[model samples]
Target chain A: MLNKHPALLKKTLSAFAVLIFWIAVWYAAAAIVGYELILPSPLNVIISFGGLIRGGEIFAAVGASLLRVMIGYIAGVAAGVITALLTDRSAVLRQILAPMLTVIKSTPVASFIMLAWMFVGNEKLPILVSFMMVLPIIWQNTEAGLSAMDKELSEVAEIYELKFAKKLRIFIIPSLLSFVIPALITSMGLAWKAGIAAEVISHCKNSIGNGIYESKTYLETPELFAWTAIVIVLSLIIEWLLKLLGRRLMKFERI
Target chain B: MNEYNIKAQNITKRFGSEIVIDNFTCDFMPDTLYSINGASGRGKTTLLRILAGLDRNFSGILDIRGKCSVMFQEHRLFPSLSAVDNILELSFEKKDPALTDMTMSTLSSLGFSPEDMKKYPDELSGGMKQRISFARALLFKSDILILDEPFKELDENLRSVISDIILGESKHRTVIVSTHEIPEIFKNSAINIQL
Candidate 1:
C-alpha cells in the first residue's frame, strides 16, 4: 500500500513529520499551561481514551452515535439522488429546489439543531440534522454530473429507443459515479460533525455527544478532550472507508 | 425497387445569425450507398447527425426510415467503459447470446484482440480508439450505418480491409459514409453528395 500511488511514500513521510511537529507543539503548550483543566496534553487524552474504553461505556456511546449517523446518511443519499434526478428532468423543479437548498445550506447547524429539538424527539434530532447536512451537497454534485453527461449517450439511447431502466443502469449510474463518489466521501465527515452537534444539543441518553456534554458540565476536561479525540478518529476512519469505496467505484476509469 | 427511403426537403440550419446549411434538399434511396463529402465547417457532420435522428436543432424535414447506427467524427467512446462494454452496453438486452457473439466477431473483424477488448479508452491509441468506435457502430447491425470520417486515423492496410467490409455491407443495406478522404469511400457509393 505504501507504493500504491506515485508519490505515496513521500506523502506518508511528510504527513508523519507534520503530525510529530504538531504533537511537540501541543506538548509544549500543555507544559506552559501546567493545568489539565485548561489544556490537556495529547498523552493525557490518549490515556483518558484507554480508561474510557476499559469501562465499555465508550462503546455504547460510539455505537449509538454510529447508528444515528448511518441511518441519516443513507436516507439523505436516497433523497438527494431522487431530488437531483427530478430536478435534472424539469426546469420547474430545478427552480423550485434551488432557493430551498440554498436556504438549507446557508443556515447554521446550530439553528437547525434548535429547530429539530423543538419539533423532533431527542432520539431523532441527530438523524434529522445529519440528513440536512448531507442533502444539498449530494444533490448539487449529482445535478452537475447529470448536466455534463456525454451527449453521445443520450443519442445512443434515443437511437436504440432503450427503456428507462436500461439507460439508468448502463449510462446514468456509471456517468454519475465521476461526480457522486467524491461528494459521498466529502459528506461523510460533514454528516458526522452535524450529527454530533445535534446530539450535544438534544441530550440523548447514551451517545458521544452526551458524554462530551457531561464532561463539560462536570468540569472533567480530560474526558472532554478524550471524547473530542474519539470523534476526530471516527471521522477520519469513516472518511478513509468512503475514499476506498470511491477508488473501487472509479476502477472503470483506470486502465 | 427501394423499400425504404430517407428524404430531406428545404433544410436550413443556423448557429446564431451565421447559416451553416442553407435551403438543402436531398433523397437517400434504400439499399444503396451514399457519401457526403465537404470541406471543414461545411456542416457534413451536422447533416449526417440530422439524418440519423441524433440532432434536431436544425430546421429540416429529414426522414430516416429505418434503425440507424452512427460513428461520430470524434470516436465518442465511453472513457469509463472497456471496448466490449462500450459496444454492448446501452442496449435493451444486456446478455443476449446472438448480440454478444456478433459484437465479438465485429471487434475481431476490426483487428481488435481479446486482450484489447478489456482495455479502457484512455489506454488505446488514436487509431485503436477509432477502430473500436467503428466496431461499435457495426455491432448495432442497423439498416442505416452512418460513418463520419471513419478512416482518418487508420493505416493503409486496415483502411482497405474496412473499406472492403463497408462495400460488402452496403450491397444489401443503406450505408451513409461521410469523409474528407473521398476516394476511400467514394469508390463503391451509388450517390455522392458534395456540400
Candidate 2:
C-alpha cells in the first residue's frame, strides 16, 4: 500500500506541475513584455478581476450570459435530438433537411450573429446564435451513435416485443446517451463562445460580451484579459460539473 | 411425442450474391435438445440470428410459436453494468419473482455466487462473463433456448457442470445449441444436424 501510494501521488503531482509551469510561463511573458496596454501581467488581470467583483458587474454579466447560453443550449439539444429521430425514421426527411443542416454547420459564427440580431431582440440574439451553432453538433454525433448501435440488441427488443418505454430504457437511450453527453459537453463550450460572440456583436446590455466590448473601447487591456480569464475559468468549471453529472447519470442508468 | 414445433422452410440468406444459408430447412420439438455441427463460415451464427428474429432479409418461412431467447457465443454483456444487471435486462417487471429467484439459483449452480453478481464484465474473467450471459438466457424463461457455443472458454469440469445445469433446467423447453465440437455437448438424445 505504501509503494502504491507514492506512485499515485507522483502521477497526481505531475499533472499539477504541468498546470503550474504554464501559469509561470504566462506570468514571465507578461512581465517581460512590460506593456500593460498590450499584455497585462497576471497580477494586473487579477486586480482588474477583483475590481469587477467589487463593482458587482462581473456577477451580473456572468449570470446574464450563463442564462442565455443555457436556454439556447437546451433548445439546441432538443431540436437536434428530435430532428435526428425524425430523419432516422424517414429518409425523405433526412434528404430534405440534410443540406440545410450542413449549411448551418458550415456558416461562420459572426455571420449568424449579425443575421440573428436582425430577426430577434438583441437579448435573444445570443441565444438564437448559440442554438444555431450547437444544433448540428448534437445532430451529427447522435445520428452516428444511433447508426452504430448493435443490431442484435434491436433484435432482442423485437423478439421480446418490448414496449416503447422498455425499448428506450433498455436499448435506445443507453446508446444515444453515450454519444449525446459527450456531444453536449463539446457543444456547451461552442455555445458559450458563439453566444458571447453574438452578444458582443449585438452590444446587449448587462452581458459579459458587453463587458468585453467596454474593455476594448476603454483600451483596458487588463480588464479584457481578466474577463477572458473569467470566461475560461467559468467554462472549465461548468465542463467539470457537467462531466461529473454525466458520470453520475451513467451510473444511474444501470448500463 | 414428436410434434414439429418450429419449422424453417427454404431459408436462403444471401449477402450480395454470396450465400450464407442456402435453402436450409429444419424442425424442432419441445423437451428435446438439438445440436448443430458445421464447418467454420457455414452460416451457424446466421441461422441463429434468423431464428432470433434479428435477420429478416433471408428468404424463408419460419413457423415459430411461444417466446424465444438467445445466448450468442460472443457473451454480449453490457460492458458498464454488473453481472446481475445484465441478467435483469431480459426480465420483465411483471415476471414472477419465483422465476427470477430460479435464475439466481441457476447462476449459483453454474458456480456464479451472489458475490460474483456485483462485479462488472471487465472485472470478471472470460469464463465467468460467459456464464453470466448463459444465466441471462436461462433466466429469460423462454419456450426455446437458442444457445450458440455457450461453453467455449470453460474448462472440462466447469463445462460439465454447466451442461448438467442446462440439461436439468431446460427439461420442459426446446433447447437448440450450435457447436463444431460435438463430443463436448454429451447430449445423448439430441438430433444432430450437420450444416
Candidate 3:
C-alpha cells in the first residue's frame, strides 16, 4: 500500500542506499583491518541472529520481556489515570499529591531501581521501575486533558440537565481519550525501555536483560546487537498495537 | 416589580472592577417574544450567559420558571456530531418523535435535504450549521429560549424564514432574542429593550 510517487520512491530508495553503503563500509573496514573482535561485519550479526532464532532463545527472551513490560506498563497507566481523576475532582488532593509526584518525576530511574531493590525482589524491580517512569507521564497528560475540556460543552450539558454519569460517559471520556491515547503510547515506550534497563541492572532471571548481561559478560558482541534489535522491534510492535487500539477506541462514527 | 414570568431586578456584573452589567433590570412575560437590541461588548452575550446559568459570578436577583435553553451567536453545534444527534442530545424521551419530526421539518423548511441529518458539522456550510443550531434550539422543550442573534449569518430569504419560524414556534413559550437587524418584527406587541 505504499505510495508509488516517483519523488517519494526516490527519497526512500536513496535512504536505503545510504544504509547499505554504511554496512558495506563497515564490512570493508573489518576486512582491511583483518580483526573479527575489533569490528564484526553485518553478516556476522545476521548469522548470530539466525543462529539465535534457530536455538529459540530469542523468542523466549522477547516474550519474557514483553510480558513484564506490558504488566508494569498497564498497571502504571491505570494507577496514573485514576490518580489524575481523583486530583482533578479535588483541588485540595491535587495540591497535596502534586509535589510528591513531581518529586518522583524529577528523580532518576537508577535511584528508584536501587531503592526499590532494598525492599523488593529482583523480579519486582523492573516492574517498580517501569511504573515509576510511566506514572508521571500519564498523570500529567490526563490532568491536562481534564483541564482543557471545553467549558461550553459543560454548559450545554447543564442546560440539558445531563446527569453526572451521562456527562462523564458522553463528554468527559471522549475528551480524555483524545489526550490519553498519545500520552499512553508515549509512556508505554518509556516503560519498556526503562523496564529492560532495570532488569539488566538487577540481572533478573528469565528476562531479555539477563540475556544481554550474559552476552556482555561473555563478550558476545553479536548477541548484544541482536538483543538490542529485538528490543527495538518489540517496542515498535507495542507502539503500533497501542495505536491500532487507540484508533478503534476513538471511532468518530460512535462519537 | 412587575407581573412577569421572569424578572431580572437590579442585576450587576463586573470583571475585575470593569462593570459589564450595571444594575440592569428587565421583565419578560410568558408567550411573548422580546428582542434585546444592544451594541457589541455591551454585555449582551454576557447577559445571555448569566441568564443561562453558565455565569454564576454576577450579582443578580432573578426569578425564572421552567427549563431554559440558549442558542449562542456562533453555532455551538458539536463538530463531531450530526445535526440530528445534536438535537437529540437535549431532547426528552417523551417528546422524541415530535422533536425528531419537528427538527427534520425545520431543516427541510430551511432548504436542507433529508440527507443533511447524516452529515457532520464540518461538512456543512456556515449557514447550514446555523440552521442546525436554530433547529436544535427551537425543537428543544424549554420555557425560556435565549437566542443570541440566531439569524445573523443567514441571507435575506433564510433570515425571513428563520424569523417567521422563531415567531411562530415561540407563540406558546417566552423567547428572548438579541438582534440588530429586523427590529420591526418585535415592534408588534413585543418588548424591544435597547442597550
Candidate 4:
C-alpha cells in the first residue's frame, strides 16, 4: 500500500541523510588536519577505491577472502549445531564441552591466530580463526533455542506419537531458526573481522587483509582507507544477504 | 487381556510440600465419553497430564493402550504455522487428499472460513484459536482424545456446536475431558468424574 511505501521511502531517506552528515563531518575533520597522510579525505579515499577497482585486483582479493570466511563460517555453523544437539541430549557431554567452549569464547582472536599460525599455514590460519570465532556463538544460541522450545508443544508431539524426524521438522527446526538466524548474522560480522585480522597477522597473499597491510606498510593512507571501505561495504552486503535468506527460510518453515 | 483402554490405580501427585492429586483411581473404557469436573487447581489438568504421559513425577500405576490426542486448556497452536497447517501437521499420512479434505471440512464445521484457515494463531481470537486446537485434536488419528477446558472461551452457540462435534468424532474413541462444569449436551451421555 501507499502508506507502507511512504514509510519505507522515509526510512531510506533518513539513512541517506545520516550517511551524508557523517561524510561531511569526515571531510571537515580531514580539512582541519591539513595532512592527507594522517587523514585521507572522503574524496581521496573514493578516488583510491576507484583506482583499485580499475586495477581489478580488488575483485580477486574480495573473492578469496569471501571464500575463506564462508567455508569456515559454514563449518562452524554445522559443528555448532551438531555439538548443541549432542550436548542438549546428554548432561555429561554438556559439562565436558562447557569449559572448552568458555575458553574458546574468552580467548582473544589475535591470540588464536598466533597460536594457529604455528600449526597451520598462513592461508589456512584465517579459516581456523574464523571458525573458532563463530563456533561458540552459534553453539550458545542454538543451545538456548533448544532449551527454550515450548514444553507444551513437545507434549503435543509426544501425545500425537510423532516420529523423531517429523518432530524435528515440524517443531525443533522452526524454533531453532528464530535463535540461529540472529546468531548467524551477528557471528558473520565477527567471523569476517577475525578472519581479516588473522590474514593480516599471517600476511596471507592475494587477500583483502594483505592488501590493507601492504597499503599501511607503504604509508598509502588513502588506499588503506579504501581497503577498509571495501571491507565495510562487503560486510554490509553479506549481512543484508543473510537477512534475506533468513526471511525466506522463516517463510518456508511456516509453510 | 485388559478390558479398559486406560486404568489408573492409586495415583498421587505432589509438588514439593503441596498435594495436587491424592490416591486417585479410575478406569476408562473404549468408545466412552468421560468428563472430569473439579474446582480450580483441583488437579484436573494434572491428572490429564499424567494420563497423557506428559508427567512422570507421580506415584501411580497407569496403563494406556493406544495413542492419545490432547487439546490443552491453553490454545497451544504453533505461532509460525497457519491455522490449517497447525491441524494438518498432525496428519501422519502427509499430502493425502482425503485427509486434507477432512481437515478443511472439520475447520469449516467449526465456523472457520476458507480465509480464516490461512491465518496464523496471532491473527486469531481466543475462541478461534480454541476451535483450531479442538479441530486439531479431532482430526488427528488417535484412540484417546483428552481435552482440558475445551469450551472455556466459546459462546453458548459455539459450545453447543463444538460439543456436538466432540460427541460425533468420539464415537469410536475414549474421550476424557476436563471442565469446571459439564455442559448440558454432555450431561446425559458423558460419565461425570468429580474430584
DockQ of each: 0.43, 0.26, 0.37, 0.44
Put down candidate 3 lDDT per residue, A1-255, tens digits, no spaces. 237588888888899999899988988987897766656677887887898899897787778778888888889998999999899999999999989897998888888788888888788888888888788889999999999988887777788777777667667888888889999899999999989998898999888999889888988887777777788888899899999999998886343
Q: Give each model a TM-score.
A: 0.91, 0.83, 0.87, 0.92
Between candidates 1 and 2, the DockQ winner: 1
Instruction: Evaluate model 3: give its lDDT.
Output: 0.81
Residue A189 Cα positional deviation in candidate 1, in Å, after optimal superposition = 1.3
Fraction of the real A/B interface contacts present in each candidate? 0.43, 0.21, 0.32, 0.50
Residue ranges of candidate 3 with Cα displaced over 4 Å: A1-3, A28-39, A164-170, A173-178, A240-255, B1-5, B16-18, B90-102
**Residue clash pairs of candidate 2:** none
Q: What would the TM-score be for candidate 3 when compared with the true structure?
A: 0.87
lDDT of 2 by residue, B1-195 (tens): 477557889999998989989888988788778887787788888898887676778897987776788887877776555777777666554446776577678778888888898788878998898888778887776888888887788888888887776676557888888887775555475778888
A best-first ranking of the candidates according to their TM-score comes to: 4, 1, 3, 2
lDDT of 3 by residue, B52-155 (tens): 67787889788776678778777877655677777776554333677778777777898889888878887888888888777777777888888888877788
Candidate 2: which stretches are off by over 4 Å?
A1-44, A160-178, A218-221, A243-255, B1-4, B14-22, B39-41, B94-100, B157-161, B164-171, B181-188
Candidate 1 docking DockQ: 0.43
Per-model CA lDDT versus the true structure:
0.84, 0.83, 0.81, 0.90
How many Å off is the CA of A43 in candidate 1? Answer: 4.0
Worst 10 residues of 3 chain A by lDDT: A33-42
